[model samples]
Structure formats: structure tokens, C-alpha cells
Target: MTFDDPAVADELILPNFNYLGYLAQGSNVAENRINGAFARLLTPTLAFTIDSSWVHQNWPTGRTSGFDKTNIGLKYEAFRDSRHEALVSVALAWGVGHSGADAPDTIQPGIFFGRGFGDLPDSVSWLRPFAITGSVIDEVPIGSGGMALAPNATTGRFDTVLSPAVETLHWGFSMQYSSLYLTKRFDGGPPKDEPLNQFVPLVEFRFDSPRGQNTAATANPGFAYVAVTWQVAAEAIIPLNRAGGTGPGFRAQLLLFLDDLMPALFGKPLLSDRPAHSQIAW
Candidate 1:
């Protein structure tokens, strides 16, 4: 449901698919993306994540596709307050460049946080089911940038060109309303096999601002069906500005919690005496 979460106990694997339609130079371009991520707890408050994606584009002139980039990162839970259902984490990630079809490598350092309103007074019990999660990552280029051959207007021939990569700020947040919280606090309990109580509806806002470039913003409205060991989610992407996109798009994701599904293998930290924990609210 969100690009990043503060919880370090989410030991899972997720695969997602996305579609985007945009206008480039007055021509409509469609992009399809397949992405996957794997996360595992190395300690009670530390985790490692690996992710990558492949993108295919259909343009007016032709079609092209390639693996975007690969990212590996470590997340450390810096703070947690169970009474307030709050969490915070610090993360550092490396984007592998030349190994893939993307651009220059990057060093991404980020902060992630999550907070639930359950601590609100009983007078506002209705808001107890709401939660907010956000993240801010700074992507700093590792080298000069990538190079490509482009036609030189003056020379009337192909010439080697340098594509300068600037630092980019990726930030986003998700607002969620969990029926699971409602059921647990007010309904006593939902009927068995009733999936409605396990649903979480959320709206996410994403913005990418690169130095010296117009910021791109997008809104994703979606819902997730969470179970004991797995989750399924879908969202519709809405461009919030001209720089975002020209048309709406969609995405779907499937996440599996290996810790819960295979406790013997994934239930404990790989190199810690502390026991593994689960942060799933439902």
C-alpha cells in the first residue's frame, strides 16, 4: 500500500505490476512495469531489503523495454512507542547502475515513519482506525552520469552526449482507514470468514522533485485485503499535474509474509538473540 514503512518486522516478499499512460512530445506512450521486493529481519530492529523492476514502453515510434535498476538497503528501527502505535526508522540504500539498464548509481538515505490514531481519546474513537505513514529519501548520484549517442544539430551526425543526473527527493505518504481496527475495538469481533473486516482503504500521495526540475506529483487511491499470511492490494494512479502524467493508470500487488507462513525458517532473526516480531496490525 505504501512504498516504504517504518516497521522492521515485515519479513515478506512482494510482487507488483503497474501501468502508466502518458503524453511525450504530443504522442501517447504507455508503460508497463513489473516489480518485486524481498525483505528479511536481521535483528529485532533491523532489516534488509532488495528490490528491482522491469519496464516496457510502447511509444509512437517503436517499443522498448529493460530492467530499470536494482536496489539493496538496510532499515533500522530508531524509535517505537507501542502505546501510541508510533514507529520511526532510518534507511540507507544503494542503487546499482551499470549492472542494469538504468542510469548512474545512487546513494539513497531515507527516513520512514508511521503513526496510528488509536491513542486518541474515546470521544474521537471513530478516528482510532486511521493511520499515517510517510517517507523521504534523497537520491544522490554516485558518478557524473550515463552517456548516450545523440544527433548533434550542428554537426548533423551522432555524437556522444552526457546525461547529467541530478539529486532527486522522493517523498510520499499514505493515509489508511483500517476496518480491522474498527472490528477489533468496536465490533467485539467480525464474523468468521467475513473478509470485509480485513480491508484497509488508503490514499497515497507521491512526489518526486529533482533539483532544478519541476516536481511530479501523483495520487494513488487503493484498498488492501490483508490476511494472516498474505495481502493483496490494488490502486488507481492519478496524475496531479502536467509533469506527473497525461492519463490515469493502475497497479496491483501481492505480498506474502514468509515469517508467518514458514515460521521455522523465517520467524527468527538471522543473527540476533532477540526474537522476531510481527508488526501487522490485522
Candidate 2:
């Protein structure tokens, strides 16, 4: 029982009266998510974006799950250099997904590259505040029980991600590592495979109000900056009897932001709604 013994695996923006949504419940399962996006700015570097998402999951043995995804995108900054204070950007994305037992029909394509470091100073600078990104995805698989679970499997997959970010005005940080490689084809012989890895970390804080009339157009306004975020992940599933080893799984997440919630929704600020939390192991 190795693959780390137990393992499991598993966005934002708005406008034009836009919307973003989240709901979560734990101790078995419950999840809901919604997202919408629209952007067009064909110059000043070029841009276009359209996005959509809906996800729902519920389990208590009585099983219930759902999935939906849609995306269209283009973004470009090509290159920028303000006397060696550099910046560059590129993006392309396409996605499609619809449920069957939580996703089977699929098509995805993505590419991204970014770098920016505007001179260094502000306190022990590491390339100003650091930035690096890389992404790739090509996945296509349709139905028939997902083609009978790896039957001549080569449904396509290749992934990579590395991110580093930091900021100061209060506090902000980011860290990420991802790897995916799945390629194997066997209908009569020779082709066996396994490789999947992921890790992520993040920290955040900010509160600024020097008058507050444009603190991002206030809707849940009246903030001077407050943020708390935590995440943990691990996965390893490579077992084809190579010493009978490797099978592991773990996940953790937590988030909190507070300024007001009607004094914890009416108990004089002792509120508990468990904001955006997640965990899984198998």
C-alpha cells in the first residue's frame, strides 16, 4: 500500500456586473464553484478572454457529482524593457469539459510564459518581487467509460508549472510546483507508466485605507486589509512493482478574511462559516 499509502488529486475574475462564487462544506463532502469572465483590449499589448465554470460535488455514499468547464483566451505583452527593468508575457488557452462521473469528455490546450523584475530595492529584493511561470496541457478523451480505463491509453497528457511571487504593502506570497506525465500504450505489449506530482504554498495579507473611495470600488468594502491563507498538497502514485513501492496522498487548505460579517452574522463576532476549505486522501 504505497503511492504514499493514501492519495487523492484535484481562478477568478469578473466584470460587466460580473460574478465569482464559492461554497464548501466538509466532513464527508460538499462543494460548489462558479466563475465568469470577460475581457477584450486589443491593444496596449493585445488581449481577449472568455471563461466559464460550474462544479458541484456531494458524497455521503449516496453519490452526486457534476462538472462543467469552458474557456477561450489570448493575451500578449510580447516584451517590455524600461531600461533593463524587464517584463514579458504570453498566453493561449482553450478548454472544454462536461460531466459523466465528474468529467470525461475533454479537450484542453494551454501555453504561458511570464517574467518580470523591475530593478531591485524595497527590502532584500530578489528580482524585485519575483515572477516565473510555465504551463502546458494537451488532453483529449471522450466516452465509452473513458475508453475502458487505459485501453491502449495515450489519451494525451503533459504538464508543468513553476511559480514564484511575492509582494509587500502589507504582505503577499506564492509558491507552486507541478508535474504530470502519462503516456503508455498497450494493446498487446510494451507500455507501462506512472508519474504525477504536485505541491503548492501561499500566504497573503493586505489592508489599506487612506480614505476609501476607490479601494477597489467597495462591495464587501470597509477593509484596511486582512488576509490569511494556507494550503498543503502531496501525491505520488508509481507502483508497478518496482520493489512494490510508492503510493501516497494528502491535501489541506484554509482561508480567512475578516473586517465585518455583521459581528459574525449576529453573535457579536465569533463567526464560523468555514470559508473555502478542502481536504482529501485516498
Candidate 3:
């Protein structure tokens, strides 16, 4: 449910703060990122989303800070089989050109899916609490917008040049074990109200592969505590190779389930008459 969800929007917002400390060019560097997502359901199986972020980095010699490009998108649940706990979705996101950091405008088309094993037979009841979610997006640049610095021949200065932006394939998946499902659906050892029942332990793996570059990958191991109207989660970011990072880092988020927090306002779709409660499981 972290990369992206196949379920229709249950109106929500997530404010996230990420920190990264690593070695860059033999110098220690630290980066802080503030980002969030605002999503709202438009129909029983359709939703709108906006994602943005700002980042600040500290280096040994100086510092740099700026806003990353923003993304606006639409997601549609293409298929679902509640009986089997499977769901699939398609999405198209547009990155605003020059929105920030001079990032090139891009069109990202993606597929998202989720599957829960809750419908398994009694023999595998233990695996019933497990779930998997994943996403695959292709980033296609609209035009050349890459920026680079070049030495000036006439003057002892540097000139900024624009180059072709690289296309990338972004993909990731998360494997989760929901204690909440265990307590609610089966006669488990722990009571429904047990503190551990609120936790969803998960591990997320992410990869970014450029058209002509080596792929960068990382694994994030974490857990999320689910509540009636809110959730809190954290993860340890572990680089899988040199292309990913030089050291470990971590990220955390606070998610607000607006539909649960204020049902009167978000209990129904803005463009449809379907009840908001019709949303599929995450």
C-alpha cells in the first residue's frame, strides 16, 4: 500500500519527513525532505492525487535547498475480485514542467496492484494475514530539460547547458503481515484490542532503472500502525548497491484517513453517488 494502492481512494493525506545521511565524494552529507500526498476519490473506482516535496541538503563546503517537481495524477481500479482479495489499477501522472528544481516535464503511466491472502483455506490460515502491493511506472520526458555546467572557452566561467533527460523505469513492491487482520478474521492468540494487533510489519523494495544506466535499488524495512482515523509508519532505507546510496537512512510518515476522520465531508465521492465506504481494502 505504500508505493501506490490499487484500491479506490478513501480520501486521505499523508505528510512525510525523510532524512538521509551518507558519504558523497568522500564528504559527509545530510539531506532532509518534506513531502506529502493529497488524494480524493472521484468515483467508486477512480481517484485524483497530487504529490509534492521540498528538499534541503547540507554538505561540507556549502548547502543546497529546493523544491522537487510536483506530480498530478489519476488512478483507476481496472479490476478487482474481493473474494480472492486481488485488485489491479492503472494510473497516469503528469509532472509539471519547471515546477521546481528545473525538472523536465514527464508523463508517467503505471500499473498498481494488491493482493491479500485472507481468503486462503484453513490450512494456511496463518498466511491469511499476509498481503502484497506493487507498482511499475515508466517516466517519459516531454522534451530535453537536463541541466549541466560547462566550462566557458572565452571566459574563466561556467555555463549552464541543457541536455536530453533520461527516461526511467520506476518499480517497487511491499510485503506486509497485518496483525489487525489476524485478530479480526481468525481466533488468534491475541485479543482484538491487543496493542500488537495494530501493527502491519512490512518490507518494501524499490528500483530505478534509467534507459542507458545501471539500475539503482534499495530495500526499506518498516512497520505501520493502523488506527481508526490515522496511521504512523517508519522505515530503514538500505541500499542494495553502490548506485543506490553510500549508507543507510530512514523515513517516516503520518497518514490521515480523512474519510474516517470526517465522514460527513468525505464520506461520498465528489463526482459520484457511491458511498465512500465502498472503497476496496488497501
User: Which candidate gets the maximum lDDT versus the true structure?
Assistant: 1
Instruction: Please list all clashing residue pairs in model 1, or write none if there are none.
Output: none
Off by over 4 Å in 1: 23-27, 148-161, 184-194, 280-282
Put down candidate 1 lDDT per residue, 26-75, tens digits, no spaces: 33678888988888889888889988888887755556677877999999
Number of clashes in every candidate structure?
0, 16, 0
The candidate that achieves the highest TM-score relative to the unseen native structure: 1
- TM-score: model 2 vs. ground truth: 0.24
For candidate 1, what is the lDDT? 0.80
lDDT of 2 by residue, 164-256 (tens): 121111111122211211123322212234222212222211121112221111111110111212122222222222121223112222212
CA RMSD, predictions in order? 3.4, 24.6, 3.8
**Order of candidates by lDDT, top first?**
1, 3, 2
**Model 1 TM-score relative to the real fold:** 0.89
Model 3 segments beyond 4 Å from truth?
Answer: 23-28, 148-163, 184-192, 277-282
TM-scores of all candidate predictions against the true structure: 0.89, 0.24, 0.88
Q: How displaced is residue 147 in candidate 2, in Å? A: 29
Instruction: Kindly indicate the candidate among 1 and 3 with the higher TM-score.
Output: 1
RMSD of 3: 3.8
lDDT of every predicted structure (CA atoms): 0.80, 0.29, 0.78
Candidate 2 Cα errors over 4 Å, as ranges: 1-29, 32-56, 59-61, 82-115, 121-282
The local lDDT score (0 to 100) that residue 115 gets in candidate 1 is 93
